[model samples]
Target: MPKQLIIRGVPDAIARDGWWLASDATLPQHEPPSPTFPILGEAMKRRMPWIASVVFLVALGDLLFWGYVPGVSLVIFAWAIFAVACASRPPKRRVIAPALLLVLASLPMVEHAQLLSFGFLTAGLLVSVAWLRIAPSRGVEVLGAAALRLSASLPVAGVKGVLNCARAVSHERANGALPAWFSAGYLMRNWAFPIGGSLVLTVLLVNANPVFERAIVQAFQIDIDLFSLMRRVLLWVGLGLLVWPFLIVQAPKAAMVVTPPKTGIKLGLNAGSVLRALVMFNLFLAVQSAMDVSILFGGASLPDGMSHASYAHRGAYPLLITAMLAGAFALAARPFLAEHRALKPLVLLWLAQNVLLTGSAAMRLELYIDVYGLTYLRIYALIWMGLVALGLIMVAWQVLRECSARWLLIRSAIWGAGALYVCAFINFAGLIAADILTRATDPTVETQTDWHYLCSLGPAASKSIAQGTWPKLQIATPFWATNCLNPQPVAMNWREWDFRTGRINGYLAVDAKMRAVRDEDPVGR
Candidate 1:
């Protein structure tokens, strides 16, 4: 029979032979078995597929495509999800969850507006997950592990259950043990086929699309192609993800065992990457707002839904700053993922993409100050957003590629996600405030409440004017850019407005002061 005795605060262990058989203190602490009570990180990693499925499924459901866009999106989203899961090399049995999710997501939705949105949401989620799984090289793995150690030592993940397993794999490698990729054929087996196939497919598919145009342009010296430009930006972003490789000199196999590290990846925790990424990400979001960038890279142009605010200047710039600053002040405290950290790797790429886009825009603006000079939410805005998205993906890719090195992906994902969600929450609040101010026709919501509110409403107000229905005035006078006195700024309405150097085409009226500011900086326009 098992023996148990309570001694004041603690329980007594087994005793025999007429005496207390005191166990050596050195013997491992009496703790839960490793199998039954598995480490938290591993458990979360196991559930990533399910979480991915849910996100994808919900997005697919939101697409709202019926007669308007042709509901082929459901099939496409399912295929994408399945393809991503397969690419992830999910544990043999894990495939079921994604498969079931794909089927469930196709459940018919009655709303017309929801179809396209759901489709987009689903596709984005699947693509993100697919991007998340790619593994970095072994050398990078070492650096990644070190970063993990340092990240953990900082007060980031413990509270939220984010740090431990959020960006799980390479984080362990950060300390010491090499992942499967370190083995001779591991690289070829793990990535070669996928990388090669993806490269060919992306090139072929993009080329096949009528709207998918690529051009070589003069930038500094060497002629730069679109692909090359994107690659350059992403390469630097990848480099930035290698934080703290030097800090953790060695790592033990036992995870959740925190150790101290002196240094970390110095590049502002991928906040720079976020700035770069936001250049494109904000643009990507903008396209959905406008009817450009196509709903699918698969085709040309997708329809825009109800959400009207384009995060052009205020959104992208603020987001970029936040992403960059988050590295030190905010980045340290959150889990490696919990979200914002998810974009850590693409810091350089994002910057480059933005630079390339801005450069391209400047070139166009130089020719026609009145038409092209002003910031417009057209193809260029989409391009900017694409740059940001691409940069972010590249950063995510860097994390995945180097997953063997830093193990930051799984752990950081949680914190990165959390940060992003928090940002989303902040956005929602601002959106509500803007809605209130739009109807209030007063300064209460704009000034007394969130100053950021005006940024979220500009595009919506522009659309209302474009449709010839002046939205119910929030203010009779120009309290902010979104007021009745002035038309939406190019920063807000530039995308959809037909533009040229001399003429302004959309709903908003153009002026000398605004046009001068818009037209002045030809180089940066």
Candidate 2:
């Protein structure tokens, strides 16, 4: 007898002869075990389930792993999953935007009580199957058809968008048209390939233990994790990519009916003002630097040195939030008051401030040139204070654009975060490079292109980090970058110097803990 399931209040044949009702499910007798989509009853029965399983597994694993949770949620999750499977015989769940959103929103809380995951899993499965109407991406022609479907449903949208998508896809396939996400001409055509690959990459990341930790932190904003930040950025970028094609392909048609960008700022003239604005920015930095000094010495005014989720805390932060208020109020209240030009002097003041801040760090670095051995200090505390101050000052003149934009998830935060990410990545790379170059012994370094390379199931990499002598080929290095975050680069840098000078053995990024492992000989000598 065929395996059966009650998909819709009735018994249905699920799989047979090694065939699955869906791709992932297979008959016990089939050459390979097959899986069931559980949403599609009959349509899925006739097709080979390989692709369905692949897509289903991505969504299902997340579902099962997340556990059972339901509400309006289960229905939505099931719909998304079904929509993906039906997109093709081995159809994918990549296009189920709603289910994707549900997964994102459904993560367990900080304490890790996963009742929420269970709710999400069930809700996710049900909800994923509900979006049968959006229609999957085909060629531009199909996309254009989908556009018409979307427009007919919208009072604001017209048929022009549908026509434009059709034309663009045709022109691009023939003469090569460019999509907006591209910095140059014709960068992306098929969103499916990238989106599909991104899902795969995300799964690999999900398996990595540290990557999981980072994902948890980003969802909760509980702590600083480099891989977590990197994952969030990539996830957003991928989401942006998925959204961009759909939006841009519809742009020309959409532009015909929509309001244009605001004209108050004036793009060309605004370019020149950017320099002056930057000067004011430096002044803002100065105020913050001075504020930090006064707070640290004048008396504890606020949480100046530690991280804060917001400005409510009454800490004399490295940033001077109050100082920028005067300039901001004037800029906003009266743009033409012509009274605001004095903001220039503050620009010079901020430049002076950063000079002091950088000098202070440099001075300390010099003190520890070889052996001062300083403890941890938040290096970018000053940089952030300065940038926030500058953006705040620029907001005063009506020239700062989005400096005062509302704080919205994945929007306002993403901008500041993108900048911070660059800073963090550069900081990490620089420190890691320095550690490896100067270390007393060679360490295991995983330079797998991007940071996400480490987010996967694998044998431990750090077990072999920082052992053996220079001029020797074999050594162990740290598996996860987190392990080396504190003791790295400086320790690594010094040891390598020792090795090159014939004072010790090898070159791998090592920490203070590896001091004894710096040499090749059994003796300490």
Q: List, in order, the clash count of every candidate structure.
A: 94, 76
Please give, for residues 226-342, the per-residue lDDT of candidate 2 as tens digits.
886786555443332322222212211211222223558543333236446556666666675676456444754655664321221223232244444434433333332234565
lDDT of 1 at 146: 37
- Tens digits of lDDT, candidate 1, 380-417: 34344334434444444544554332444354454544
After best superposition, candidate 1 residue 488: deviation in angstroms? 12
TM-score of each: 0.22, 0.27
Say which candidate scores most in TM-score.
2
Give the alpha-carbon lDDT of every model: 0.39, 0.38
By summed lDDT, which 10 consecutive residues of candidate 2 come out lowest?
Answer: 495-504
- In model 2, what is the error at residue 345, expressed in angstroms? 11
